[model samples]
Target: MASNKPAPEAPSRFGSEYVDDFATRPATAFGTEYGADYATDYGTDRGSDFGNDFRADETGPERAWEEWNPTEESVRPVRGKHRVAKQRNGLARSSTVLGVGVIAAVGAGGMATAQSKPPVSISLPDSIADNLPDAKSLPGVGALFSGGSEAEAQEAVVASAPLTTAGITTAEAEQGSTDAGEALRARILQQAEQQQDAADAEVKAAAETAAAEKAAAEAKKQQDAAEAKIAAEKKKAAEEAAKKAEALRLAKLAASYAIPTSSYTITSTFGEAGSMWSSGYHTGLDFAAPTGTPIKAIHSGTVKSAGYSGSYGYRTVLELEDGTELWFCHQSSMDVSIGQRVTTGDTIGRVGATGNVTGPHLHLEVHTADGTGIDPMAWLRARGLTV
Candidate 1:
């Protein structure tokens, strides 16, 4: 027969002191004796005990140990949750690397395509096509775009090709630039030529004007010369006509007067100097003739006196209309009476040897209205008589 009392409890593996403390302290998942200081060790030692400490009835280290000891299935999810998060981060890093690789591959492919392909086709309008150079004929155009060595031959074929999305070819752009430069140069040359032409025109006009002026001056000179010649001819004609008129007047005057005597020789002229006269010079003209030669009147006039003087024998005085007195001395006889009218060429007296004469001669004297005598030979010549 056994007594009914329980046996004494065994000491804990931790120690009796720990068990005694655990019995006296408040209940916790980790034993009160272990407290916060032993919790990490207990959790680490019972890492597989998951269901032990979580029970309501379990307390202290016993419950902590039981709860801490867990199966692999129960704890596997917690570690797997963190591992899933890490695996997601790694996947994101792998995606970023793959995207970068794809971008690099696409960029390389685009660069290769751009280097191999030709540029875009450019169509010229019909109006400008005739003026532009053939696209293929441009340098490097056929080889660079049309895939041909002969640029000229490939021009037509390339022109018919379909249009592409690329831009204008390099050759076409260069041709356009060259054409524009040529056009600008042509315009400049044209303007220069026009300016030169205008200058030439101005010079020609000036030359023409100068030539015209010179011609006009020459014409004027010729005209002046002609006018001078004409004027000189007219003056000469007028002088000749005046000379003819004077000759006619002198002829008529000669017809109006007559000589005093005819067939007589002149012995002495008026103003002759000799020792024969009472004065120092002979004052009358002498005409020697036969003693009975007839004496004519010099002009139409009245007989002023007829008488015999001391040295003059049978002298007669005739008075003309102008009051000039003509005296005929040493006459044989007086034909006209005193105060009788006489005509030209009338026989007024005859020549004779007078008292003072050396031989038979007629002494003719001319006296003015005041009785002043002048040379009778000059007086006869003034009346158009040669005597």
Candidate 2:
């Protein structure tokens, strides 16, 4: 182990002098250290140089300490330079912008949601109940929507909301939609009936028109036939009247052709003298005169005879083409010979009482060519001469 030894002391001073021992230099100590040590060391002296230095520091004498403001090192100027963007700064700004965009998107989405909402009400009419038919009365209708879900029932009720609120029964609401359906069925039936009636009326009218036309045509035809018959009858009557007039004219012509040969006082008619004469009382008219009275022809004719006869002394006969013979008997002189042509009022002979004559007279006889005797007065009356 090492010996524990203390270190040697350093040199010492006493007051204001270097001294080996301080008490031995009391005068130097008083004038130096011991004299003003407290006052000069800390400037606490009242009248020493140290005291003067303290007073000067308080009184600003000769600037013992200068006035001191804070320099750049103490309070550096507040930095005004714009800060650069870094990852940390960018993150803060991005967070603020994202917050505003989220707010705007939220507002736009809320408006779209409001616009897409459905209506809660519907409109319907009162008279809709009268149109529907009863579903209960229809065949197989009860099983149509039976055993359905509540959602199905809600849908069905909502669909039938128009009818139910209009006071329609559930049975009636199941039948149809509108009143127009019922009206259409009724209109169809009524139109069919009307068509049948119209067709029947048209047929009847056509038959009536045809009948009227036929009747009119028949009446016209009958009238035409009647007119034709009347015309034929009138023509026949006119022709008959003309024939009668011609006959009358011919009869008048015949009556004017007769003449009497002798002018006599007493005459014998043609048929009445037969009973009074010996062969005949007088065959002709008797003119009581002397003999030789002139005899003339009554009409133009050819002389057929001028000879004697048994009862009459001479006789003359004339004939005409119409087969009439004129005889003159008891002539005294015959001027007309046989085959001689004589004219009316020509002197043919002289009247004489030659044979069987009570007085001078002439017997005249008119005979047909077939020797048939007729009434001479009647025959002459037919020639249009009054005899």
Whole-model lDDT values for every prediction: 0.69, 0.59
lDDT of 1 by residue, 47-96 (tens): 22223333211333321111145688666744432211113334553344
- What residue runs in model 1 are displaced by over 4 Å at the alpha carbon? 1-232
TM-score of each: 0.43, 0.35
Q: Write the per-residue lDDT of candidate 2 for residues 77-193, one digit (tens) a residue.
A: 666643332234346433433343333323322211111223346544657755666664333443344765666655665555443235443554466524444545655787998
Q: Give the RMSD in angstroms, all C-alphas superposed, for model 1.
A: 28.8
TM-score leader: 1
Against the true structure, whose lDDT is highest?
1
Span of ten consecutive residues with least summed lDDT in model 2:
108-117
